[model samples]
Target: MITAYKKNDMTSFKIKVVGVGGAGGNIVQKIYLSGLGCETIILNTDSQAISRHRAHHLITIGKTVTRGGGAGADPDLGKKAAEESIHEILLKIQNADLLILVAGLGNGTGSGASPVIAKYAREKNILTVGVFTLPFEAEGKKDVAFKAIAEMEKYLNTMGIIDNNVISELVSMESSVKDAFDLVDRVVKNCVESIISIVQETSDVNVDFNDLKSLISRGGLGYFAKGIAEKPEDVDKAIESVVFNPLLTGVTISDVKGALINIKSNGELTMNHFREILDKIRAHLPEKAPIKYGLQKEGDHRVDSYAEIYLIGTTGKRTTDEVIDKITSKQTNWKNFEIPPGVRKHKK
Candidate 1:
């Protein structure tokens, strides 16, 4: 068994993505399928849920309460189940250098247990990044959902929030809710993979794990922006698509304190191309905040003209509005819920 705190306790330099509950577990399976060069684990109250999932590592918790059945949307029961299995979770994450948590809030296990797990990991001083999905307005339990997020943000290095309503709107008109969610999982995976590439893969310019560590550890609500552009004219649109992506609750370049820019492009990427891209991105960001950049060159030479760029940054402080608001619309019926404290925004 991999022991905990094997590396430097504050940072592991290893990456682990843990998914809590059914929706969270489902997303974990998607990221696992991508083979992103990180350890992936799934935790759930349902034995059948774990059995069907494809992650190499799986933990079924709360078998006593639910008897391998589901949480039945009872968040209180979900939280209790996670407490019962905290020991196993601690052991599983003992050696992690960086932990990325995935889940869909508003449900029982994701909303209840995920925050508990994040708290334990943070107590160990592990760098924790959260990638979470909120339910559609139609779900009606925004109270439980946002509470879980606020609790987790107290310990997260950065958190990426994806609005399921946005996902629902962007997906094919004929798609099922499951299909829409699966598509949203792909968005989550892409954003997380972009971050993973920075730490795990070598870059021509070099933005190592240490840089990422410094950025997240300094304390702030995390923000991530990503876009792909091929034509020279599409620069603004590409960058806008990323920074102003609808998935983010209401975050912008203005929300973060520092920034890291990374480019994954073909060999055709030229100095002129990079400089223009950099200039354009910087033109919109605050003049005072520092920007760290790196480049990854791909061998594909089939007349490629597109580059995928990831801009990762977050503020040392996030306002209450940023936490509870959405980029596209207002929550007409969610007003009864109080804004949870210590909230961070994460978008995929």
Candidate 2:
């Protein structure tokens, strides 16, 4: 079970999670309902989509153009709507110190509005992070999704990309389509919650706002995975969950530029537990890559000892400007959906 932190406890910094479009809205709703310590907002071109979810704020963009209608899977139309209604969007996010923009790329609203909003937030000097998902191969929207991701990467301080194909692979064969999607939502929620806990919750070694800002803001992509252990014997299980997380497929562990790890136990954590976990992680990291962690005692007491580990890792040194050049150059072909090599894809 995820624990919620009170608003009053957020005295150190202000964080806001803005969900855009259908997939984005669902993810934000989960985070909000989980009781994480942050403000939540839902933005969509479709009024009905916004109505379906509850958030701290519900906004309808491009009112003059879209008039509460859906973007109809048109990226151009989606971008126009956000551009026209940016004033309203700005109002809701002006006070946020950290802005996390969640969206599902390849469709109209998410693919279009996400980049526009992220760019504007950065202009206000707000630290921005983007958590996005690509469409499955069968959707045939690879071009649309990659284009949006490239654009978003140019603006966001750091971003995590989860291929729908990879997510789908995690579900059992008998699971429904909805089950596969829910798993994606859960994975995203865990990431947002873990990052919040790292900075918001008090720990023996706290990872503060500055620590987070520094690590993610570095040029590259971000990766997140979490695991839980019920006893001393389960430490390896927990480490494997984090180090070899299936959600982070295609990652080159050696390319990791840096990482931030958070560990929580149910009041019975020992030094050996910490050492075993960190040592295993350190072995995979580049010698020069910086690593930071926060340790605390918190979790279920169903067993004598319980531990949860959360990791966020970064790879490569590709700056946002560099990525934009590669994405926008005329040599690039949208039809082919060409992106930097090494991003794995799956077929069903």
Candidate 3:
């Protein structure tokens, strides 16, 4: 098992951002400028596409397409591009305490390569997290995006991933491409900041490999909530406080029946405390949902219960093996997910 460290004890973190032509490159550039203090590496297939936006730290991988840089016809080519890019990036990530991946899916490069990169990072025992963008419905790239999303969802169900709908939610908020880019830039910036905060602030709370695996496997954005309460009765109040606000409130897509609940504490995760927390959560969930709980003794912070509860959803029918097979079965053309023609001059 890989040894874990407290947040404060972590000395360095390395983040790699991969993109398929200009979109991925643009996002990586924004993240580099966000000033998170972590070592940053940018990986792309086309050197020419990212040449102007390249930073001293950015590293280009693979070859650019001489012709059309759009999504490829053959699926296998995408996987090949990703594998090669990841093989190169792995050398740079040797001792990184944390790995953050940024990319937009549906395109050949980012969609194809992300999973390979994620698998490699996990094998190295680095805590890997992905911040990915979904394609817009109107982009005529929906099928490509959907396939990529399905693959991503399948991979993420067993690994760490954070989904951001850039084209739909982020772009629609603004009128111009510049405005959309700025909005996405801000979102990516906030995400990087939050991650940095978690790494920098020392916490007695230890997130084990099992916990990380379980979290990335079964949890999604709606599964997370944060609040503090000292007593059993107060726990309900805490969850309620967050749920009352429409913006903070979220609903789970999965039934959550037969779901497992794991709780960790520096002290004891008492039966009484467990019941209190479980009951509070159940109050918001469906009455028939079956829940189970487990406890650990590592968290030791006083200002807060140092408590976090995660809910795992298992409604999807897709299996991990099927996803892997699909990814591996395809030929590695690597050229399909290239930058489109005439979209020159990468933007911030």
Candidate 4:
């Protein structure tokens, strides 16, 4: 059985997992089903879509404009929907200790509403972290998604990203439709789960909610990786595998500003094993950066001497204007940059 610790009571931290669009809603649904003990809500322009999903709450935005139909892949309308219903959204998010915004950018609701809601949460002094999936080239939404991401960087405390193209190459290929989506949802669920578990799961080392708050509130990109190590020596290897994990698609840890490393094993885990894991992980990173780490060992008889190590950290590089300008460079005479159509249908 898993042993959960308590220093700052879990009840004191009010966490709301808000699903922004169809994709976001779907991800949040999986997280809710995992029973992580957070309030889950789905926000969408599609009334029909939200009605079909299961969550603690369902919020339909831009009811007057979209008539409860959908955003029609228009980011402008998605933004307007959130704007029109800003009051209700804020009310729902009020007093939240942390907000995890889940969505797949490139759709009207996800692309448009994500940035707006993030900015609103920041205005209220609530820490916000965005978990998102980029559109595939087949979906013809990358260019649009890029613009939305640039805007979101301004308000989000940290962005945890997964590229759909990478997911296609690594996970969804060769699988049936339902199975493929199950794989996709698992990635999203794992990303959200890893972070929440860091805060909610108690340990002897205690990487509590406040520690996570300090790590995320720096306003840059967030990196989270978790995997198992079969042997004591495999602890470092587990962390290395996470660096190239598909969920983080395109990030490098060479220049991380701040980092938190966590490792867990069965009851036989030792402090020496934990220290070596931290040392090995740091050896791969920049020399000067100090690392914060924690350890936990659950007394499960079925498990032996194995370790599950997670690396959670962020680099402060929120230069929204420069990044967008570099992305949409005026210096180059590039082609129309339009993605091809005939991709899968939209979902949160």
Off by over 4 Å in 2: 1-11, 249-252, 297-305, 319-348
Overall local distance difference test of candidate 2: 0.74
Error of 1 at 75 (Å): 1.7
Error of 3 at 52 (Å): 2.2
Provide the TM-score for each candidate, comma-separated: 0.82, 0.85, 0.54, 0.82
* Candidate 1, 289-309: lDDT as tens digits: 778877755523532556767
Error of 4 at 194 (Å): 2.3
> Per-prediction RMSD in angstroms?
8.5, 7.5, 11.4, 7.5
> Looking at candidate 3, what is the lDDT of residue 28?
66
Q: Show where candidate 3 strays beyond 4 Å.
A: 1-21, 64-75, 153-174, 203-348
**TM-score of candidate 1 relative to the true fold:** 0.82
lDDT, candidates in the order shown = 0.71, 0.74, 0.47, 0.73
Output the worst ten-in-a-row residue range by lDDT, candidate 2: 330-339
Write candidate 3's Cα lDDT for 1-348 as tens digits: 112333334433344434344556676676667554566666555556656675435555544431224334333455676565565677777676566666766666666666676667667876655555545545455466546655555334432222333223222332656654555544444444434433333344433334334434443332322334454455555444322211111223233333444444536446576567666666655666554444444455532464544334232234545433333332111111111233222344
lDDT of 2 at 178: 70
What's the C-alpha lDDT at position 329 in model 4?
38
Q: After superposition, how far is residue 223 of candidate 1 from its true place, in Å?
A: 1.9
Which candidate do you rate higher for lDDT, 1 or 3?
A: 1
- The candidate that achieves the highest TM-score relative to the unseen native structure: 2
User: CA shift at 319, candidate 4, in angstroms?
Assistant: 0.9
